[model samples]
Target: MSAIQALSRQLYQSKLPWTFEFNFNEPDYIEQYWTHLGGDLTFNRPINMMSLPSHFIHEPLPGASATLATISHQQALQYMSAQHLQQSFLLSVHQYLMQNIQNNIQLEHTAEHFQMSSATLKRKLKKHQTHFQAQLDQSRLHTAIHLYRVHGFKTEQISQYLQINDTTNFRRAFKRWSGLTVQAAQS
Candidate 1:
């Protein structure tokens, strides 16, 4: 397995919460990481008040001054709140993605229009403790909940509008986001 995958797997399996810091100065290590991990992972400082995933963030490892890094999850909720705040970079991306998704525009196209390199965008979102997949899913969930409860769109039509090809993924993501089924949310 690649180092990033190894790191990710270890992160998921770790029982305790911690933030991890990355050593970004070493071009070789950073290059290998991006190479192995597909350019989505990077050590970057997030925007104001943003936080990172618990597994991949922490204070700099002791005396490791070449590059500061950490491994912790304490900032996870902070990151979530930051992402949810209005006009955050993720929110901007989310709004743009939603507008385009409604028009059937591709994610790559949306990423490009925003002047974000795919890797940079992905890493920034990751630093904020979510993935593009999750953000897109959240956008769809926002639509689903609104239509089901507030706007009164039918499930099938909502599914079509949201571009959720698989009914199962829609249902699963809805429950994951809202702690209730779509139908339950409507009622």
Candidate 2:
């Protein structure tokens, strides 16, 4: 396998979030190759690196020359660590929303925190196949599940924690998310 293919496989198998950086300019064929394998590519100017989510299928690029560069194992590990720290921007935004789930999370608030305009944030999320409200619903559902299962919180408590005004709405939303009523989930 080529280096990029091998690296992509390793990252996917490890199940850790990562961003791949290529030193040379990514030819159009390379981009197409990755895209066909369900990878999203973001090009960085001056750096010649392509950032993508970790869960991508790697296919060999047609007519690609295999140029192997020998590197120490420790250097490879360090490179992997750096890549893990550079997760997709959309994921970082989701994580930020998850951390602030107790408060009323808003797109404007998240955008300001990320130092991007609200439109830019929306565009980025859209590129990643999600929207602000969708992410909020996901975060709330995740938090609700954790509180319900781990802390034994009741529906009312979860609703309050999530800042939902009505427990009935919370129940409905929870059922929609998990296909089970809160009480049903608890039992």
Candidate 3:
């Protein structure tokens, strides 16, 4: 969220003195945060919302940004575009893997789902400094962590939910993923 605010500031530097409006999915904002936002603090967020996405928006006054912001604008655009491409692929892969966590994961099937050959998927992931296994491990580890710590699920339950088929195997896999025993991890 701070990244979004800073990016908005740079992108709208030409329109300095712009009014900032924030809509947070969280119920409240810290008053300290308003000091850095550099605009009027007006609250127009939804009420009684359980889940929503937060937004950092800049509302320039009338006739603001009449001139170009130039270097900052160009740099911001370049950064955003590069980040979008690189992160989009990884995010897509993670989302797909997460949704099918209970199933046996396979690189070939994942490649097919992405409409590409297995080798092509491997190449793309390598370019991003990762491979299929790392992504899969990350997804599994996160799910395991959440289930174990947050939901207080037993090892057997987690193993069954993740379809690992055996409690001992799940324990070993969990140790490998997190470098800690399940009980130790909870502590």
Candidate 4:
């Protein structure tokens, strides 16, 4: 089962209303849930409806028992397909970076990681209409946004994680990727 489906199943098994903040329709809903959970967790980032399904299993009812349940096979297949695509994109980007971002690193390392020649990798990326730099920039932007918003990390830390020299470029690039500044992106 996909993360979201597993979460939904856990929610149903707990016999609790699927609830928590980040309900896209209600800005204040998540804060209240965090309060009820006796902690200060917050979905400080801008909430989107598509992200809701991922959290359903996280808020379990107290005094509830877990149960094994089944979902429709067709729905399961569809969920798995979407999940596989997401995982593939994430893993490829991650592995590509891991093998290519060391000192004097090169694209040839990324191609080697994929067990293909650099030329083949280039051709495949062209067919997809994307380049490695674009994907790397996107991955960095996504990670920076998440860390800054969710963990309240500073710009310097974010830049460091992205393996960039300075925070200024990180800030400028972040603002370009996300309309909000890093400071503003939090909450």
Q: Which stretches of candidate 3 lie over 4 Å from their true place?
A: 1-87
Per-candidate TM-scores read 0.48, 0.55, 0.55, 0.53
- lDDT tens digits by residue: candidate 2, 88-152: 78678769988999887888999999999999999988898989988887778778867865577
Output the better candidate (1/4) by lDDT: 1
After superposing candidate 1, which stretches have Cα over 4 Å from the reference? 1-86, 103-107, 166-169
Model 2 lDDT, full chain set: 0.68
User: Model 3, 157: alpha-carbon shift in Å?
Assistant: 0.4
Question: CA lDDT of 47 in candidate 3?
Answer: 14
Off by over 4 Å in 2: 1-85
Error of 2 at 74 (Å): 12
Report RMSD for candidate 4: 8.6
Candidate 4: clashing pairs of residues: 21-30
**TM-score of predicted structure 3:** 0.55
Please report, in order, the local distance difference test score of every candidate based on alpha carbons. Answer: 0.60, 0.68, 0.70, 0.58
Q: Can you write out model 4's per-residue Cα lDDT over 1-187, one digit (the tens) per residue?
A: 1345356556466423332323124345556544443232334333321234445547565545444223455677788898874555446756667544433345687778778898987787777778776666655666775676557788888788777789898888877665557776664
| Backbone N/Cα/C clashes per model | 22, 0, 0, 1
Could you give the C-alpha RMSD of every candidate to the true structure, in order shown? 16.1, 14.2, 12.6, 8.6
| Candidate with the larger TM-score of 1 and 3 | 3
Model 4 regions lying over 4 Å from their true place: 1-10, 13-58, 61-91, 94-105
